[model samples]
Target: MMATADEGVILVVEDDGAVRNLVATALDVHGYRHREAASATAALLDLTSSTDINLVILDLGLPDRDGVEVIEALRGWSRMPVIVLSARQEDADKVAALDAGADDYLTKPFSVEELLARVRVALRRLAYDSPATPTEAAIYRNGELLIDFGAGVATRGGEELHLTPIEYKLLALLARNTGKVLTHNYILKEVWGEAVASDLPSLRVFMATLRKKIEPDPANPRYLQTHVGIGYRMLRVEEAARL
Candidate 1:
């Protein structure tokens, strides 16, 4: 079944009582059903006990275990969307959480509105990516950018884009995982095959070229967003517009 925007339960895991309450209250105000857990153990227990948890807002500084461990454990069996809401603002911390399978990362003292927006985006992506949702067309569209996977081509503003083989592969990879941040290592393995070593410099060159083809203004990219030391994300049209 195609879940509605706010149809599923969201679990908020935070060791701080004030922050937990704040997040939970915001969710409640926004008409989202949510559960709270103060530790990784409790969070994992709730996830295992209930089949209704479709998303998680986790704090990395958990009392029992770090949130990345929780993400790793969850990834062992589930592909559920996890948004890390932590005080850790380091680029390495963000990269670690993302590489561990977190869907998004938000620093501490975050905006409640931004948090809700991320939640909405995650749920929508879940619905779109669902096996039961009937995405047989296999086409990806965000604003002027359209990737016709069936035809093995991409177009912008009604014109076909002339992309090299490597550029095309990179575009296809990001389009397939739209709205999610993909790590450099993940992209390298997918595009260049598993045997390829960490070639971030090459990836950056390819991505820069790919952006020039799709983005109207490559200097300020509207489609592809860079997470600096982390990786990249394909923003949906609406999200890109706000950027």
Candidate 2:
């Protein structure tokens, strides 16, 4: 098998042997090292044991447990990229999988080209950016939105925007960790402190308010992307690397 250090590992979790083999073949063709898990239990065990597995391609109908359960369980500890592959075509099913912490979803009968594209996008997010070091620039910008870490300010379209303390902290956290999904618990602990880390409702409300101010369309945000059940991701630097 052809492999490079940068072609990160993927875990294919599907109950069907044929689907698993197909996905594994695609991964191999694309130069991604992969492992196959026929059940959620096996997938979780692989996740716990393999430090190098960078992504998961999960199916919703596992023999032992639902794939959403797998996503939920995985999000409890790791934010590895999880792109759900399922035959369930309902909007509710997609939403459930995404909200359960799956990063992206693909319905059955998907094209290999589209699947590869999604894989690239997800892996690029994981590989292209590292956490901000102390020496890194304090200001982060994506077109209209700008976060100034030094001044502790967030602005849109070159205008100063008013934000509550918690809102500012949340924005700062997202800005600092752009491209990476921040789970609700992690965000709460960082912004609200560990004392109130379990307050999910408060986080949701604040996120909504922050979106309204920074996003041109709060209904459809550009800068803040929600990982549904997982958390949120600020636009990755690679998406705007040319700027």
Candidate 3:
């Protein structure tokens, strides 16, 4: 998914030799180049040292150290896309990983197709993993508040935001449309996929967080205006001269 005309690398960190090779081979068949690390320490080393690694498939069970530690440890500075692999299929487990900055999670005995799809979702979440031109990428700016579409960075009142993956995705979607009347379904499709379009509760929570970050007042939203049954919009602020 590198913008440049070269192969991008995906790092697979799994303790199981068979699983590691299986996942790596699947990626290879899908035309993605990759490297593998068997232990958490080596994974950290690969993550820290490489500028080539675009994404990671991380196993939560490691030989040398705890897998959650690897995530907590990597999240200290890196924002690279991380898709956690876990044998536990509990909702709490998935939530925990997501809350800790993992992009997505896959339970064991997963299909290769699903694995590739999750990787695609992670790449999409990263907001500039494709070969799109910088100019074509969507962005929004109003004085001190700025949203860079290609960079996946949001700033408000002149300070950068440390947004989660879902938050960033929602921001990009709204920022792209700006004044347009984007429906709730539209927003869901753009951010969480069509499958979760009816999951308004989840979307509402994300929207509320987005308002708190970008709006002058979350209760009385200024930048992000809600249209009730409709979706939200990032209002285009007019210059003082216009008034």
* Candidate with best TM-score: 3
> Considering every candidate listed, which one attains the maximal lDDT?
1
| Each prediction's TM-score versus the true structure | 0.58, 0.58, 0.64
What's the candidate order when arranged by decreasing TM-score? 3, 1, 2
Q: State each candidate's clash count.
A: 0, 1, 0
Candidate 2 RMSD computed on C-alpha atoms after optimal superposition onto the true structure: 13.4
**Residue 220, candidate 2: alpha-carbon lDDT:** 61
lDDT of 3 by residue, 147-180 (tens): 7776667898778876777778877777777778
Q: Candidate 2: which pairs clash?
A: 99-229
Candidate 2 per-residue lDDT, tens place, 1-243, comes to: 344677678899998998888888888886888889999889899999888899899999999999999999988888777888899977668656655666666779876766776677567656534564576447888777888765667788899976644566678888888889999999977754454556575467567767877888777677888888999999853463432
Alpha-carbon runs more than 4 Å astray in model 2: 1-3, 133-243
Give me the runs in candidate 3 sitting further than 4 Å from their true place. Answer: 1-5, 121-151, 177-189, 192-243
> Candidate 1 residues 16-128, lDDT tens each?
99999999989888788889999999999998889889999999999889999999998887877888899987666866676676766678788887677667766765654
Candidate 1 segments exceeding 4 Å error:
1-6, 132-243
lDDT of 1: 0.80
Tell me the whole-model lDDT of each prediction, alpha carbons only. 0.80, 0.76, 0.74
Best first by lDDT, ranked: 1, 2, 3
